[model samples]
Target: MTALLSFWPLFRRQIGRLGLTLLLSVLTLAAGVALLWVSGWFLTAAALTTAGVSFNLFGPSSLIRGLSLVRILSRYGEKLIGHDATLRLLSTLRSWLFGRLFPRVPLAGRDLRHGDLVSRLTADVDTLDTVFLTAFGPLLTAALIGAGMAAGLFMLLPAAGPIYAATLILALIGVPALLLWLSRRIGAELVEASAALRILTLDRIDGHADLVAFGAMAESDRDFEAATRRLARARRGLGRAGTLAALAVQALAGMALIGTLWCGITALRHGEIDGPLLVGLLLAVLASFEATAMLVRSVGKFGAAATAAQRVRAIAQMRPAITDPKRPVALKQGDLAFNQVTFGFDPARPVLRELSLNLLSGERVAITGESGSGKSTLLALALRLHDPQVGSIEIGSTDIRTVSQADLHAHVALLSQNAPVFLGTLRDNLLIGRAEANDAELWSALEAARIADFVRALPDGLDAFVGEAGRTLSAGQARRLCLARVLLSPAAVLVFDEPTAGLDRETELDFLGDLAAATRGRSVILATHAQIPPGAVDKVYELADGRLSSRPSMRG
Candidate 1:
């Protein structure tokens, strides 16, 4: 519940539209109660009045017609405005989540799987759409309608008023509260089970090829079945709890009606109320309980909504691993240097210790090391994905930390080993590097990366659609396409982490041979295990034991 309240600020942004929707909802339900109340009174009065007795039928008939119209129109307006506001809120929520997600990329120290992250972004966010549309709106409207009916009864029948009010308060608050309590754990389990099922499904699909190759399809099936059973059990538990609460509410409504009827009968014997008026008030009481039934149905999902809110808030509230300086200095082009830097995921065990290196402008340098030797960590530090615990990385004279991340990133472009090719057109994938890059510039980048001929051979040329993760392209083709993207970036310093990875030996050698010409005017920091060709770089350093020992340049 506390987690759900945290989102009130975001919810308040749509308050105007939501408030109007709430008003229309009240009108719709009020008209329904009034329609029933007036109908009962009119019918009874007409039946008792003798022939030729002047009892006005026109006023009641007109009111009934007007109320029916109001109910129909208000109900329509309520749905239209309510759905619109909820959708807008969801849209804003997605954008805000993405903003929070970007700075936390690589999500260090978090065990968040890709599929689980997808579940939170999609299904969990969709669940919150019910927060206002079904839950809060219905609860508030029911309370208002219940109070109005109770007040009317108090004015007419003094004895029945307290009974109806007490019954209603119990039905509206007590039953739903009990349901939420009993189903809180069940609801949270249901959400987790559903996300687990989604994660497992996606994981299996992603690893289907390996599963088939290993003849483990049967094992995968068993795992999937277990997940489905967990989800089913959670759903059944929540449904059972809701069903019992609903029955309790029905029982309360019955008690209210019987108590009101007994009071009305006694009043009639004492000549305190007429049959028509008593019947009218009794029908109104029944109509008002309709609101409680709606409230019960919506509140059944409240526990799940609250749990979903907590899951989403957990992600949004995480402190980013890195942030921009309070007052950022503008980045300027100069030598890229890492001076006496030391960093590690765990402070007790450092990965890079007192490492220092410098690459003058337009100079290409290669750093080679075995896997897990912090070669990738070096590039990440340069990009400011994570700052070093001690010492500073500088671009010219400015400490990279003193500049905005956006500014630092704008000057340094990195192509990591696992770079992805998004689902879009070939042109669309390239445009991510430089949104305003012209066709000529894109073609030039592709040519430099040596993937231009393959792209041109396609029927759609640049417009050819690429599958998600570049599944449509071979490993080598995807690698080169990503390389083209980095090459297309306007950054002065280009950092490549295993840039020649995934390519055949022949293609790899050609890429290394042409490295100098391809990045003529920009400084290149290449981290790789590939053999560097003569003239490929001005210098090479092999990283061992968290230190760099420079090897003489192979360049002419």
Candidate 2:
């Protein structure tokens, strides 16, 4: 019930379009009933003439032709209006769901796989088309058509009217309610099965290299097969539920037909109703059951669509662990300070404890320590990726938490140990740091990073395509490309976290010299455990057991 209710707001927002569609559907059904009643009248006129009764009310051919034309026109209008409204409603829903997902992305990022998230946003949301086309449209049309049939029957034969009404009410209302209850259980199982299958498929693709390297390809295939089997079982259960609901509707229609026949026969004997009226009543009763059967199928479709809606709602409702301040302060020159700051990715296990540091403008500071000594954590704090639980970090004169993240990042540029190499041309990647830079500027940045010669050696020069995750380039080449990107940013402060971690000795020295030359007048913070180059830095800080202290230059 709760899952079904969540779609109400989405439905209400599109009520204008839905209402128009509903009106057209009602008109279509009314025309169909009028045609059926008129055809019966024409048949009765022919019968009376054969029996020598002089009752020529009207021409049978004209009435039948006119009703048929009206029915065809109404059906065409219904198709045109209903489909137009459905498409407009679908577009609105897609936009709303995307807006809701964007703000909560960071919070949900860690918990969801990339492939699975993409599937839910696209394939899962598309399932709601069934709700619009089959459920909402058919359900409304059935109700209106059933009511009209009952009223017409009453005017023709009083006792037959109540019986037809009761049968319709039970088929359209009672049977659907019971089927929906059963569908809820089936829907839940299907949701779980599909989610598991999506995750497993993504995992297999991402871990393909690992599985092959460890000779576990067979095991991986087995797991994927298990997930597929579970999904198939759940789908079969939902199909079975649909079949049962259909059978129940058919049984009710048969019973209604039997009761209507019995009453029509009694009326014929007493001369209360003529033979033509009885035939018309029987035809109307049978035709009305078609709408009831459509209603039953629609209820089952709604149940399946409700499952998809719940998953989408869960993603939309997540609150980010980090949120921008209501009123953010602007950042200027980058003079960073950490005052007794402490933090942890997990609260129970601290990564940094009461750390304090300060760096002035244009000062090249080196942070060196053993592995797991909170080197990367300090850089993350400076970038404001995560907030400190205990103290404060300030860039220039403003606290980081008081300023917008974009403003804070504009003052600082970071090139981490695992620098992300996006899939693009050399020129494309460099332009990310400074979008307005021309070709001349891109070549200049590449030359400064000591990789211009290598880039020019390629067949396409700056336009060469780097495959996914820069797979086409070596680790050293990829690292230099990242450095070239940061160099083009021209920020006041630069932080390099183990930038030369996996480079060859010759490449490392050349890159270090280029970095030292490019960052002469800028504030530079290098976090590394490698031996520091002489004349490359102005000051050095070594961290031990969460405590930081200044150290003498290696040159001395």
Candidate 3:
């Protein structure tokens, strides 16, 4: 219920469009009922006139023709207006939800299932359309059409009006309520099972390289197939409830039509209404019930909509792992420091213990450590990806916890290990570091990273497709591309985490040699397990056993 209410703000913003949409729906249903009623009366009157019961031929014919035209025009208008409104509504809804969740999504998703998160953003969010199309619109139109029919019948025949109104009203409320209850559990089960299926499928596709390395691709395939089979079964389970509810709703509508016919016959015999009038009333009642009958199918799926809402709301409301201080201190130095910092991804196994280091302006420092020895954690601490549980990290004189994330990032930029390459042109990936950087600056950064010639060699150059995660480029080329991207940043300090992790020995040394010329006046910290030769950096620190020790040479 709370998840459903969160949309009230989005609803308020679109009130005008939704109102027009509902009004058009009411108008469309009203026209259908009106046309049916007018045609029935006209046919009956024309038949009596042929038998010498005086009636104006022109008036009846004109009434029938006019109602038919209104019905056709309104039906077309209703479809156009309703669909336009729905499309606009869905776009606004997706944009609004994405904007709310994008900021914290990176860290918030660290503990979340990747496939489920995608499902939430894509499939689950789409499920909400049922709330609008099936639940909200149909329920409102059913009530409006029902009330209008009841009011008209009351003026036509007092006794027959209550009888027909009561019968139709019961079917509208009772049938939907029963269907909703029966399918509630099935709806939730299907949504959950589908989300699980999406997660397993995505995991297999995304971890293709790792699965092949470990020869587990067959296992991954089997897991995906199992999930698919389960989802099919859950869908079949929900269909059973839907099928039963459909039959029940049709039976109710049939009974209401039969009752209307019986009521009209009794009313006509008692001199309460003429033959044409009686025929008109029975036809109107029959057509009006159609509006409510469509709602039975939608109400059964309400549980799934509610469950999807809960998932989306939970993600949107997740607190960020890092947040800005209420009053941030000035951040104006290329110098970085960590003072006896202690931290961990988990409390029982701390990654950094009393770690301390300092890199002043124009200095190049290298920290070499074995795998899983907290090399990346040091960069994360300096960037304030997460605050340390004990001690403090500082930029200049202010503790980093006192500096806003924006300020910290403006001073320090990290070219991370296995940096993700998005699916876009070469220019789009580089723009992430500095959105406003021009072509000349981009060329300069690429030249510094020793990849300018490679890019210029391509037919489309910067406009060429990079493919998903830079699948078009070799591992060495992708790293250089990422390095070029980082160089485009205006941050005073450049941090590189294993930027050449998988490169050949000679190429890694050559890349390291180029770093000095590229970052002449700024601070640089390169965290890696690889050996850095003399002159590539002014100082080297070995990070092992959760401590940093100064080294005089490239020796371990």
Candidate 4:
């Protein structure tokens, strides 16, 4: 119920459109009921008449034709309006969910898998189509049709009208309440099983290479089969519940029909009611039953859509851990400072302990440390990826936390280990840093990164495809391409994390020398464990035992 209510605001915004659709749907339903009643009345009236059933075909034919036209037109109008309104509502909902999700993604604590997030965005949002198409439409139609049936029954046979109304109320209210209770547990279980299957399938696909190498393909298949079987069992339970609910509704409709007929016969024998009016009442009762059945099916679909809505809401409501200050500070020369910073990815396990450092403008500093010694972590702080628990990171005399992430990145360029290589031409990837860079500027940056000859060697030159993640390129070439990206950017600060990793000594030194020369007038922080090239950096800082210490030049 709470989850259903959450969708009302968006629904209310489109109420005018929904109301128009509902009016058309109701008119269509009413026309069908009237046609059935009038046709039955005419056939019975002619049979009982002494004129041998050949009196007025024109009147009955006209009514039938008009009813048919109304039914078709109303149904067409209803579908057009209903689908248009639903699409608009869905668009609004997806926009709202995306707006809420963007800020939370950088800080969401849950280890959300990429595949799971994709499922939420695509599959989960799509499931909500049933909420409007099935649930809201049928519910509104049932209410209007049930009300009209009750009023028409009273006009025909006053004694039985109350009984018919009570029966309908019970079916509409009591049956749904009972079914909701029973299916709540089953629905929740099915949803969980479905999510588990998604996660397992995605994991298997992502780790396919590893599984094949280890000969664990059969084991993975068994696990997936188990998940599928669990989901099947849950679906079977849901089917059984639906069957039972349908049976209950049908039984109630039978009782209502029988009771109405019995009362009608008594009234007719007592000379208190006519045959035509009783027949009309009976037809309306059956039509109401049809509407009730649709309502039940709609409710079941709503249950499924409600489960999906909850998952989307959970993701859309998460708050980001880091947000720009209301009044953001602008960065200038990129002089960075870390003041007594003590931080950790997890609170109990500290990565940097009261660590502090400072970098002057136009200086090239190389940070070297053992694995897990917080070298990359320090660079992350400079980039403001995570805020420290107790201390501050400042850029050009302003705390980075006081600046927006966009502003921070605008002034600083970071080329981390395993830099992302998108699938596109070499020029496409290089121009990502500076979108307006011309052919000359691109070749210049590529040459400066020591990869111009390699780029020229390709048949298409700058137009050559790098393939996915640059899989076609060698490790050193990929690294140089990433460096070219950073070099092309106009940022004041450049931080390279292991830029020379996985390269030969000569190639590593040449790239380092080129990078240092390219950013001669800017602040550059090179976080690497490789030996620094002679005269490549203004200073060298080694991080050991969770502290930064200056190292004497080995070349001197």
Candidate 5:
């Protein structure tokens, strides 16, 4: 339950809307109780008056009609308004959560991490609906109605109100305490089991081909089945706890009904209250208990909501690996540089040690190295995907960290194997590079990347769909498309990580030539093991001995 407190800020953001929903719910409940309470008095008074001499009927009849109309109208308004407000809040919350999640996604080797994050952003975010709709909304409405009912009873019969109050407290407080206690562990377990099931399921689906090729499908199936079973078990435990809490509330209601009746009879015998009022009070108790009935079961869901809240809060609280300085420095030019930078994935083994280099504007350079050498890490550091542990990487004499992230990215854009080619149309995917770019500009960039003729020949042209991860295109085609995306950027420094990795030798050289033409007058850093042709680049550097090399070498 404590974990759910983190959502208070989010709730407060929509407090005005939520407050209206709560108001409607209370009005709906109060009107229904009032209708039944007044009807009871009207019927009893009418019967007694018919049996005796003269009795006033107009006042009771008018009140009964008015309350009945209020009950129907308020009920309709309550459901419509309450549901609208809550659904809108959930929609806004989902958008906000995705905004928080987008920049925080881990890029490299993200199998389980991706799955876990998806579960949190999707299912776990959806679970927060329970917090507003099932937990707080119902509970708050029930408390308000209960208090009003208690006060009404106290004015009618002093002793009967105390009895009703005791029962209300037992239903609202005591039963919920037990329900929460019983549900906490089971609810947490349910959340874990659910998240585990989603992750394993996603992992299998994402890696189905590999598992089948390796003859490991049976083991994955078994793991999936086991996770599903655990989730089912936890759900059943929570269901049982919910059932027990409901029964306890029903029992408390029964006690309250019996106690109210006993108090009424004793008071009538002592001439303390009249018969019409007694029947009205009895009916009021019955109708008012209905208002709190759902709340008793809703208490158990607080535990489930708390578990989900903790998971979501965990992700929301994650700090980014790179962030802008409090006071930003504006970069005045496009020259990129690395000054004595050092970094290691593990503290004991360094991948890049005192690595320093420069790429002046309009210069094209290549970094060639063996697989383990850190060519890719150098580009990643320069892109500020990861910060250097020891040195400063600067653009135009301003440290990257001392500049706004958006401003840094505006100058330095990296196109790599890691760049996402989403499931969308070619035009939609290209527009991600620059939203304001026109069709003519897009075609020009694609032509420079050497893929424009192919797209032009297609029936849909820019409207043609690029399947998931651009799987519909060949390896060379996807690379060219990604290059076109970077070409569309307003960046001055363009970094390519293994831009033409798997192409044939002739195609690789042709692609490099195309790249040279496309990147004219822009700073380019190509991190690849492939050898580049003579006139394609200004300088060639190899990653060896933990630094760049000036001399040509066939070591890699």
Candidate 6:
């Protein structure tokens, strides 16, 4: 419940739409109750009146028709408006969640699986639709209708009013409270089990080949069966709890009806109220309980919604590893420098110690090192993906930390070792590099990356749809496609980690040979284990033992 409140600000944005939906829901319920009440009174009076005795049929008949029409129209409007507003709210939530998620990428120390994250973003968000659409609106409408019915009973049959109100109050509050308390643990378990099943399914799908190769298909099947069983058990428990709560509500409704009937009959014996009005009140009471029925059905879902809300809010509450400065300094064109920078995943064992280097504007420098020698870590620091433990990185003589991360990123772009070619058309993926780039610019970047001829040969050309992670293309082609995206970025400094990876030796040398011409006028930081050809870069350095030493360009 508290978790649901955290999203109140986002909910408040749709107040006007939600308010109208709520009003229509109330109208729908009210009309239904009134329609039932009028119908009962009209039929009873018509039957009791003597033949040809002056009895008004036109008024009661007219009200029944009007209420029936109102119920239909208002029910339609409620469904239409409620669904529209709920969908719009969900869309906004996804966008808001993604906006927060981006800055927290490489979420250090949070061992969140990809499949689990997907579940949170998609299934969990969908569960929240019940929060307002089903649970909140129905509960409030039930209360309103119940209160109205109680007030009318008090005015007409004073003896039954208190009894009806008390029973209704118990049905509305006590039943749901009991349901929530009973279902709370099981509901949370149900959500976890569902997410676990999803995660396992995704994992098996992704690792199908490995499982087959290792002859572990039987083991995987057993694991999957276990997860399914857990999910089934949790679902069964929640269902039982919901069933009990619904029964409790029905029991309370029975009590209210029987008590009202007894009080009305007693009043009739004393010449207090007539049969026609008594029948009408009894029918209205039954119809009014319809609202509580809807609420009971939706309350079962509220438990799950609360669990989903907690999962979603957990992610939203995480503090981002990086944030922009309050008063950011504008970056200017100058040398990129690392001044006595030191960092480590565990501070006691530093990956880079007192690392200091400088790359002048427009200079191409290559850093070669063995695996785990902090090459990628150093590049990450330069991009401010993670701040240094003990020192400052400066661009143009200003501390990089002093400038906004967005400004710093605009000045620098990176193509990491495992860079992805997202699932989209060639043009769509390239647009991510520079949304405003013209076709000519895209073509030029593709050509520079040595993949332009391949795309041109395809029937769709730039419009060719690349499968997920560029699965449709060969590994070498996919790497080149990602390289093209980095090349398309409008930045002064271009950083590549294993830029020529996946290419054949000959092609690797060719690309490296043309590196100077390909990235002309931009500062380049290349980290790789590949040999650097002569004149490919302005300087070469070897990284070993968390420090750099100047080295001559190596011959391929």
Q: By lDDT, who's the top model here? A: 1
Candidate 5's error at 396, in angstroms? 4.1
Model 3 lDDT tens row, 1-556: 5687777787666677777778877887888898889888888877777655466778767876886787677767767766776677678778977887766745632667878888998887788754776777888888899889888887987666776676666667876777667666777777888999888878777888899999998888888788888778777866777777667766766765666667767778888779988788778887888887766666766778878888888888888778788998888674688889888878577788888888888888998988899888888888888788888987776798888888888889988877888899999999998999999999999998889999999999998899999999988789889988888999888898998788898878877778877877888899977778667778898888888999885432
The 10-residue segment with the lowest total lDDT in model 2: 101-110
lDDT ranking of the models: 1, 6, 5, 4, 3, 2
Error of 2 at 8 (Å): 3.5
Q: What is every candidate's alpha-carbon RMSD to the true fold?
A: 3.4, 5.5, 3.3, 4.6, 4.1, 3.1
Model 4 clash pairs are none
> Which regions in candidate 6 have their CA more than 4 angstroms from the true location?
52-62, 214-222, 421-428, 438-440, 450-481, 500-514, 529-535, 549-551, 554-556
Error of 2 at 144 (Å): 1.8
Q: Which stretches of candidate 3 lie over 4 Å from their true place?
A: 51-83, 105-111, 207-230, 423-425, 454-477, 501-510, 531-534, 553-556
State the weakest 10-residue window (summed lDDT) of model 6: 547-556
How well does candidate 3 score on lDDT at residue 191?
Answer: 83
Candidates ranked, most accurate by TM-score first: 6, 3, 1, 5, 4, 2
Model 2 lDDT on a 0 to 1 scale: 0.80
TM-score of 2: 0.75
**What is candidate 1's lDDT per residue for 251-340, written digit by digit as tens?**
988999999999999999999999999888888888898989888888867878988988888888888999888999999999999999
Candidate 2 residues 81-108, lDDT tens each? 7677667667877888888876564452
lDDT of each: 0.90, 0.80, 0.80, 0.83, 0.83, 0.89
For candidate 5, the per-residue lDDT at 13 reads 72
Q: After superposition on all CA atoms, how large is the RMSD of candidate 4?
A: 4.6
RMSD to the native, candidate 3? 3.3
Q: Where does candidate 5 have its weakest 10-residue lDDT segment?
A: 103-112
lDDT of 4 by residue, 1-556 (tens): 5775787887888899888988998898888888777776767766667776567868976998899899899999999999998898889888888899877756435767776787778777777754766877877887898889889888778888888888898888888777777777777677767888888888998899999999999999999999999999988987888788888888888888888999999999999987866776677677778877887776766566777788788788766767889988777665788899988888678788888888888888889889889998888888787789888988878888888898898888999887888899899999998999999999988888889999999999999999999998988899889888888998888998987778889878777777766777889899998888777788888887768899865442
The superposed Cα distance between candidate 5 and the true structure at residue 74, in angstroms, equals 3.3
